[model samples]
Target: MTEATATRTDAQATAPAKQTKKVHLIIERQDNPNSQPYTEEFLVDYVPGMNVIACLMAIQRNPVNKDGKPVAPVAWEMNCLEEVCGACMMVINGKPRQACSAIVDKLQQPIRLKPARTFPVVRDLVVDRSRMFEALKKIKAWIPIDGTYDLGPGPRMPERDRQWAYELSRCFTCGACVEACPNVNERSSYIGPFAISQARLFNAHPTGAMHREERLEALMGEGGIHECGNSQNCVQVCPKGIPLTTSIAAMNRQVTYYALGSWLKK
Candidate 1:
């Protein structure tokens, strides 16, 4: 064969490989809360800059599986695709993260998607994150006020303190930190790192400080800061980089101080 023809032949041989691009996903699906969980494999045409949410959307549009059979489209929750909502938290390839931010290009082949098992699975990828919210309530994660009449402006925080509090406030109740934490499993009632961080946030507020001792006491109770195993998985998996371990440590100190003070008074 001529050298030019040989080069053309080589190009022809390689063209098919380059032309065919696919994103493989193995998603864990649960039909209902009482049903057994199973896996479903999917293949989608690879697209540039595609995130897991995008891939799921494609699958939703097609509703076909790897076996060339029609199947129910996978279910998931998502909002604020920009990663602020944290509604799309799931275990992608064994790491809990936001599906909207998990770029396909950054993930390995046959990417595994599972519901954040720390919470009860509502469906395929949707989990009932109410537990985390309940934990928040347990710690009184909000400032209280009597709404009968308008209250004047509340106390202001220092600029430096405000900046850090802003960081803690970034938590959108996404369960990534809780999902990554081993102590936050079914048998454990550990409130997780986000609650401790939130307590820190509220405790810093001059008005919120009125309930600070109550929050501290809550943290000192069961499923509180003492339950943290110091695995540090929470800090690593947090999509917002919220310095969870730092919050946990700070809360630990605050709880200790409060307990000592209470004991002295008694």
Candidate 2:
């Protein structure tokens, strides 16, 4: 062969081969609440703009693992395909967040998925978030306006309060705060930071404030604000950036005053 052709052939032979890109997922799955947990590895074709949920959907479509064996499709929950619903929250890479928003490109290789430890695992990535909801119910996290109808617009809150209240209203009970909070584990009855912040949200409303005492009363009971360990993990994991710790302090003051007033009136 000619020298130039020989050099070209040598260079082409030494060049690295193009690698096929694929996403690696290490997911912890459970068949049932009482079932033993197991890990499954999955590999899906990498596509730009794909998120963790998208990767999981790809696996679901195929139901095959990294070993090329057919298996039960990994079970999980998702709604709205947006962050608002908070249905797909899980421990992604050791942080609890919405899977729909977990962009595969932004995540590190061998992305890990597990059910959040704060709640009971239903199956796979699905968890029972009912504890957080129960806390909401315990705090009466809603305004009541049903007597004989014609309640109309109720009352208006001051602009200053309304501005901050709007921020608090963004909470969709996503439970990220609860999941990150160390105080909200199996041993403690802490209502979680989200509930405390939610109590503040409704209490600031003019109409909602009318039932403020009731909410505060609930906050003073078991699984109330007093159970907070002040670890401040809730604020770090909250997707909405809600001022959870500040709300906790605010509610603490309310509870303190509430307890004092109750004693004085007796």
Candidate 3:
């Protein structure tokens, strides 16, 4: 064998090993709803196809800080890791999103995760979304169905309307839109964009239309559709890309007509 060829083989064999990649995370944590929140940093080994949730799980297993101190396991909520349940929703890198679907590779370094401040914080990354649920209740966002008896096939809706309704129904009450909106805050009792969209969704339904007048009446009250600032932030941050602004617009028209009809009756 040639001496030059042997020398090249030895050089290739002695090459330095590839360095392991890591994901750096900065998480805002609150011990309880009333406790002061603080920041903690963690380093997690990077794995191919890993997501934000995966990074969190790694921290859970190690429970160590970037300073090498053993600490409490970072608490966060997650379910249906496919991004359907929305339980894993949090402020990721200043944008509200589902951690289960946030790919680690795509996010910028020093990824940040925080609880959505739109709702009361429960702990770490979990927040109380009851405000949205209460809004849904006030709007009567449901179709009145009779007893569980067999009522086969209610009225049918046109294909066009059904398609759009399906889009509005995609809201899982993740509170992303609420977090993005500037109007939703402690001082404001606004029912929020999702409730307005939900009101529109039910008002257009074949069976839900039965309560359409009632729904409109609820919206005409305080914290109804009038509270929206038209900031358009809700649609921009909505992960599902639901037509939130469009729904709010449609409900505005409905409320106007309802108000006019009531005035005429007086």
lDDT of each: 0.93, 0.90, 0.92
Residues 1-266, candidate 3: write the lDDT tens digits. Answer: 69999998887787656356789999999999899999999999999999999999999999999999999898888989997888999999999999998999899989999999888999999899988888899989998787779888889998999999999999999989999999988888888898999999998899999899889988988788898999999999988999999999999998898899889999
Winner by TM-score between candidate 2 and candidate 1: 1
lDDT of 2 by residue, 86-165 (tens): 89989999999999999998999899999986889998999999988898999999989888868688876789989998
C-alpha RMSD of candidate 2: 3.3
Model 3: residue 64 alpha-carbon error in angstroms? 0.3
Candidate 3 residues lying further than 4 Å off, grouped into runs, are 1-18, 148-152
Q: Pairs clashing in candidate 1?
A: none
Candidate achieving higher TM-score, 1 or 3: 1
TM-score: model 3 vs. ground truth = 0.91
Better by lDDT, candidate 2 or 1? 1
Each prediction's TM-score against the native?
A: 0.94, 0.92, 0.91
Worst window of 10 by summed lDDT in candidate 1: 12-21
Model 1, stretches more than 4 Å misplaced?
1-20
Candidate 2: segments with Cα more than 4 A from true spot: 1-19
Best by lDDT: 1
Q: List the residue pairs that clash in candidate 2.
A: none
